[model samples]
Target: MSVPKLLIFILLIFGSSTAFAQHEEEKFDAAGTILHHILDTHDWHITDIPTGTDAEGHATYTPIALHLPWFFYSSRDGFTFASGTESLLEKGYVPYHEGLYPLKAGVSVAEHMDDHGHLEIHMEEEAFKEAYVDEAVTVIDLSLTKTSLQMILIGLLLLFVFRGVAKAYQRREGQAPKGFQGAMEVVIIFIRDEVARPYLGDKAMVFLPYLLTLFFFIWFANLFGLMPFNSNIAGNISVTSALAVLTFIIIQVNGTKDYWRHIFNTPGVPWWLKFGIPIMPIVEVIGIFTKPFALAVRLFANITAGHFMVLGLVSLIFIMSNAGENVAGGLGIMPISVLFSLVIFALEMIVAIVQPFIFTLLTAVFVGMAMESHDDHH
Candidate 1:
């Protein structure tokens, strides 16, 4: 068979398996299911096995989840640590909505899923606090979540891969590159010559490490998100926000006097815009913030959207089948849906690589802009 034919066969098998696997749920909430997969959770969820039916006749599946250690601080209890949710619950904490809350008396942790498939937090913020503990009590979540653990693993993977590449360079000094090292050298040189040097100029070496780390971390995280049973690290806004903040800090710290002066009093611009209304200065200050904001949102949105597309397409099979109640309908749409999903999966792979490149290139441009001198511009 041709490669395209083989690819279609693989997608059909994968999609069919996924669709049947989801049949365990009596009722499928497509949005809720998608959100559950994309969002961070306290534990790593492997799969769900049908146990029995609930009182309402809805199917119940016991989730097979892998728990990470829980470490959080509560004003009422001071410091607390537990191996996982069960242990934490033993310590009077309940894992609710990806957070650990104190399980107070006369309180219930419940979730309401609407007909439209949106999950409504059963408790209001104040009510939630009242249920969990006293209003004055504060909880600080220091626990390792699914997303956090994935990020840490990605960091370790980068270390391992690059360490090998580093050794190859040292051992084969002055020799032509081969295999893995050659492939990595292509990327590293691409970033150094095409991204870092172009923007950072003579100071490329100074910022190369940070740029490389930023690029590889994001690219690895994105790729991992596409893998089976892996957390969407790049899709999480908090992760992207932290990365943006790092870039923001680097830009500000490296900002030359000329950079600030340009923001405050943009050269060659109307003095009226600078002094009379302070419009130029205001816009410049806002630009400083918007740069990082754009960086964070772009990566997070792009990555998240790709996952949503892939999940949504697969979900259509189950939804149309009505969780196996209408298997005929599902079979009818299966081919089209799976075909679209396969197309999207291919595109997402490209996006997984391109998004990081864009992010790193922009970072270099921003930093280089900060290091610009008045004399250089003139």
Candidate 2:
């Protein structure tokens, strides 16, 4: 079939599934539905299905979700564990939104909230301690969330693919590359020659492994996020932050004396700027941190915005449907929604490839700059 037809077919299948789930509720919460898909959670929600009806005759849905393990720690309970959120909830834990909280007897989670909608304690200091005297049983959530699980899957994929490719190389020592090996070789060479060598120069080989790993990991993670019924791994700020931190550490550790001097005692700048007020030094110091901060935010924002575009477009159909009241309106909007979602998905595919290259390139550039000598400036 044609590309347009294929997109329409896929969108129809996807949209209908989600719409059916949303229709189970009296009011379709577009924001909640969208957020639930985007955010990290303890459970992997595949889809929802109509199970039966409530006593009041309202529709009920049984979410086909994968319940992941929950790990929590608190001073009172020490290290505690549960099979999943359901088990914890059954054991006196309150399920509020995406998190679980332990409430004192007769004290509902809603009763403790302040005006701003956040959970806050307004009682006196002594009373506050008395209320939670069981040693702050608000367990610290260290569980492996959806994002972390997706990352682990990506790691396994990389390990398996590369291990196979490595065996192929051993078998065919000098033969002409073919099949998957050839495709993998093309990317590996591109990063080594085009990306790493230019910036890292003589040290390219030293950093080649790191650069290649960064590229493949980010690229794979991005592609995984685009898949249907998968978690948005790269879009999670925590993941990006960890990647950025790695780059930051490498750059700082490899920084030469000249790099440090350039920041604290800039050579070319006027003495007044360097020593009198120390403005330049402060700005330079801030730049050290801001570089990685920008890297993290850029990747996170681009990936997340791409998801929002696709999901938002798909959401239009259900929003226009008005809980199935305006069927004709929803049908009329389907074509437009599918077309836009297709375009965004295509653009996102390109972004998935390009963002990884950009990140690797910038990381190399930062490392190279840090290794620059005082003579290079002259």
Q: Which sections of candidate 1 miss by over 4 Å?
A: 1-27, 49-63, 90-92, 103-133, 376-378
Q: Write the per-residue lDDT of candidate 2 for residues 1-378, one digit (tens) a residue.
A: 235544544554466557656665564566556666778888888888998988879777877878788877755567767785446644545444556556465544456654434344445555654554334566677788888898899989999998999899999999988899999999999999899999999999999999999999999999989998889988888889999999999999999999999899988889999889899999999999999998998888778777877887887887788858899989999999999999999999999989999999999999999997778454
Candidate 1, residues 286-372, lDDT tens digits: the string is 999999999998898888878877887888898789888999989998999989989999998999999999999999999999997
**What overall lDDT goes with each candidate model?**
0.84, 0.80
Candidate 2: clashing pairs of residues: none
| Model 2 alpha-carbon miss at residue 127, Å | 18
lDDT of 1 at 136: 58
Q: List the residue pairs that clash in candidate 1.
A: none
Q: What's the lDDT for candidate 2? A: 0.80
